[model samples]
Target chain A: MTPSLEAVGLTKRFNSFTALDHLNLKVEGSKCVGFLGPNGAGKTTTLKMFTDLIFPSEGESFINGISVQQDRKRALAVCGDLIETPEIYPSLTPREALEMSGALRGMRPEEIRSRSAAVLEEVKMTEWTDQKVGRFSKGMKQRVNIAAALLSDPEVVILDEPSTGLDPRGMAEVRSIVRGLKKGHRLIFMSSHILSEVVDVCDDVALLDRGKLLFADTLANVSQRLGGNTRSVEAEFAAPVEDSVLANEIGSLPEVASWSRADARRVTLQVKGGPAEQARLLRQLASLSMGLISFRESRSALEEVYLREISVGDA
Target chain B: MSADVAPARAGSLPIADGAIGTVPGTIAQAITLSRYQLRDYLRSRRFVLMIAIVVAVGTILTTLVAYYRPVGLIDNANNLYGSLWGGGAAFLILFAGIIFGGDAIAGEFQNKTGYFLMGLPLRRVTVYAGKYLAVLVASVVSILLFLAIVVGNAVFYLGVGAVGDLGQLFESFALALLYLLALMGFVFLFSSMFKTSLYAVLVVAVLFLFGFSIIQSVVLALTGTEPWFLLSYVNQIIAYPLTGVPEHVARATIGRATITNYAPTYFEGIAVMLGYFFLTTIGGLLLFEREEFT
Candidate 1:
């Protein structure tokens, strides 16, 4: 069965200040959707609504096709969430914390026992399983927090900036741990203002700003939507290559709208069609043996998209 | 934990929400949560510290009564019990409740742990009830342990027979438990109403310790009436049972006019205390439910 999350004209107001305004979006399971926006964009607010931490001024949130506002318990049964930078009780060990979470989620004692071990290992926190969380670092606490969130093996996992306050190593470790949660085709809804964080973990992105959904689609589709019927890709190579010779070799491909040498080892090309033709061109370019290091879309596409959408909303 | 967000690694199938067995009922959830709460308190240093204080106080009281036999205080074990537990019982009940329940809901919000809890499948009322139940059980245990110290002293001084009537002690013990529940509910109400634990603790301390008594005295002096609604006024019924059966509405002549002084009977005390239990417990839950994690 398909699990889904939807926000229907959802609005939230903190008295005179409106946090979210008639936000409408729906997402299905089996995809890692990034809830992306800048600070004060209400990404966190929207996530809170989905979990019913705060009631909305208007509208409703549905999870797994059940109304969260009307029946939060049933709606949230399939969800596991880590919102903001919530800390566990300092006195509680990782084992106890996960056990409590698992027990509340209705897992059997045997299941809690087994999954407690499993999730701790998943987050690489087995060593600190019995250690009081008080002495643990922020990163350590965060890992334990995530472990608790996954205790139920929820179909939909929600995290707000899973690596927000961690050091670089901690962030990398968190990202790596998040990568390991791909078993059983669970839907991971992660929110972050950090573009790199979203880009690193999300398969699709829902962009919100000032509590409004500006865009929602796969990266490729977003490029198509905002790149304005065009795709600009940058191909990077390992060593310096003759620009003219490189351009001349694949310059005549029908999908190549235009090609320019970014530098001795890089070429910026405006391409057309979609992933199919792009793959075909990649094969042709790789065959040239011009030290073709890596080929991917240019950042300008999303940079342009962010600026366009946010600026329009600002207007 | 989030699944890999990179496009290449995301899952390609949707797992159903009810794939797992159904979430347990709310009551079951509350009990499961309470076990953790109890364990937390049991393991905490405060529990040990509180116990040590009670033992020390009991030892001093026991020694003073047995050897010194101060003035007219200890005519018998019954008198000794009444003197030891009288006003001191109110403080015990109030202190025990505050120590456990004062930070209950506020700590969750202050520390942002409520975000983690509210995100779960259990309802808000389940969490509130769980915390309250945990505090109630723990407070009852703490208060009883203190009473045991006093009882040991009574047995040592006046022998097992002098420890007062077992039935009365039991009745007193029952009243103490009721007081525990009522006071805990009051603490929980403050806990839920406030956003910070420090404020919750302070408000509870000030109100229960001195604020209520002062207000009750003032109300009685001015209105020529007993403050029947004030918990501290009616809470005396616990120790009053140790001395005599209370007249529900005691009357006395003061100054020029005959003023009435009201003291709750067993049932009146139960009614007032249980009213506190239900009213504040429900009030706290409502506040807890409406609160935003942000």
Candidate 2:
């Protein structure tokens, strides 16, 4: 099946500064693809290019099958976007802005009303419909923007930093709302300095660093591909064992990937293999009178991967 | 243009008739876009308030002037010319220019909202034209209301008298609108060029209010030539009955030499204004087309 959105060798430059460089991306229809990066890593720039907010200085992007650079309007017909800092005429209430957006997108007036009401309810912003968006808090404005985006029932939705300035509950609500959209439309979500949010929601993720795509794959696939001989365990002592003894116990485990005295009373171990192997190693440590405090798999989180890749680019 | 660029059907869905299909027609899109813009303008309370005040002031001033028949050559000249300078024409141009033109692109950039609006299924040109037409319509509406008040006063006070100068009045009013349009076009151009509303307003005001006048005066004084053909110098060309007015020594005015010497003919003035209007608008849009909004 044809991809819903695709970018090949996309590059953008602002005078002397290269904002994006030789980057490639693709999102299969009906999937939520997370874009992960650091500040100035080109995530926003790439999203802008895809939405036709900014032209790619090099390469091309397609929405559905139409080239965004060539037939921008046709390509945009199936797409809706909410970039950073949602804008509306300050005096217009949320409902008014949504109505105008709906009309412009060719929705019938009735469709506009129903769709606005539906999306407002979905975003939990129904009560704020009459309030001017200018008076809204950032999160409220974002919800209004999201409502406008959904008015046309677009086939693809692109959100940049979608959860910025939202409360925890608001963030979770937005996440679920985006997840709900996955069955009917593809989603391209860009976030810098927010890994866990994307990790929880995206089917696939592309990690970027200094305007280049470092890795793009499913979360599990990326973890497997970057597999390392490392694991972590936390062990407690019934009577407070000495660090020396704990270290010695940790050193004795044959599967111990690495060991160190985490503190005077506990030892942390890095072990080879997966969580199962790590669990067995923890049990062995328990036999040595080192009662376990807690244990978790020791590996690179998305944050670590993001930092490591960006630092590498810096070098 | 490929064969695929045919007009769209109802609901704007693509037809797979083996023939090349274009996007929806420009007319439909233009209508929708313009409607959206008009709604925005009307919904803006500040703009609505400003319009109401402008219209009320215009009507009040016209009624009082026509009733009193304030007599003086300049007063009579102002009756012919005051509408141009004082009848909210300049004020409307400046005010509408800011509301409609200043925020055209600058606010989009400053707010970082270009991504949302520009991402829609509309060409950049369509968006620009729709906005321009909407502003033009709004400006025209307000100014026309002001005109209606003036004409009403003329009928009431002048006793429906034959002025024998209806053609001149038409010429003056038409020229005023053209001048305002040209002014708005440059303001739009400046708005597109800058990334802040204040900068756009400041630049346009300087060009029209000060820069154009200063340069015109310098040229006239230095070259001993007629420079009223210049935009700022030709205010009287389209909006006044004054063929001559002695320079006012009590009130300091710049560009005296320029206004006295070389004002453009009505046709020449119209050509210049139209040229500026069309060229600046197209140029502004073209520059905007290639710009990357961050």
Q: Pick the candidate with the highest lDDT.
A: 1
| lDDT (10s digit) by residue, model 2, range A1-315 | 333667777899989999888776666645777888878889888888887888888887766656788878777777778877667767678888887676666677787788889999999999999987879998898888888877777767778888888999998998888878876634445454567777777777788777888877776665565348354555555566665665565676788766776566655666777667866776776666556565554334555466667777788
Quickly count the clashes in candidate 2.
8
How far out, in Å, is residue A229 in model 2? 5.1
Q: How well is each residue in B190-264 modelled by candidate 1, as lDDT tens digits? A: 999999998999999999879998999899888867687888887888876568876766677778877676776
Q: Model 2, range B1-294, lDDT digits (tens) per residue?
A: 011112221232342121111335566766766776676676776568657766777766765665666665223433544443334565556566666667766766787556556767778777777777777777777666766665555555454551443555666667778877787778778878988878987887777777877888788668756664566665545555323333322233586622334546665666788887888888888877877777
**What lDDT score belongs to each candidate, Candidate 1 first?**
0.79, 0.68
* lDDT of each residue in A1-315, candidate 1, tens digit only: 666777777899998998898887877867788888878999989999998988999887777667788888888888888988787777788888888888888788898999889888887889999999878987888888888888887888889888877888878877776677655667888998777766776778888898777778886666666553557789998988675676677677777888888887788887876778789889988887877889898864556577678888888
Candidate 2 docking classification: acceptable
Off by over 4 Å in 1: A226-300, B1-19, B71-75, B246-262
Tell me how each candidate scores on DockQ against the true complex. Answer: 0.29, 0.27
Chain A: TM-score in each model: 0.79, 0.88
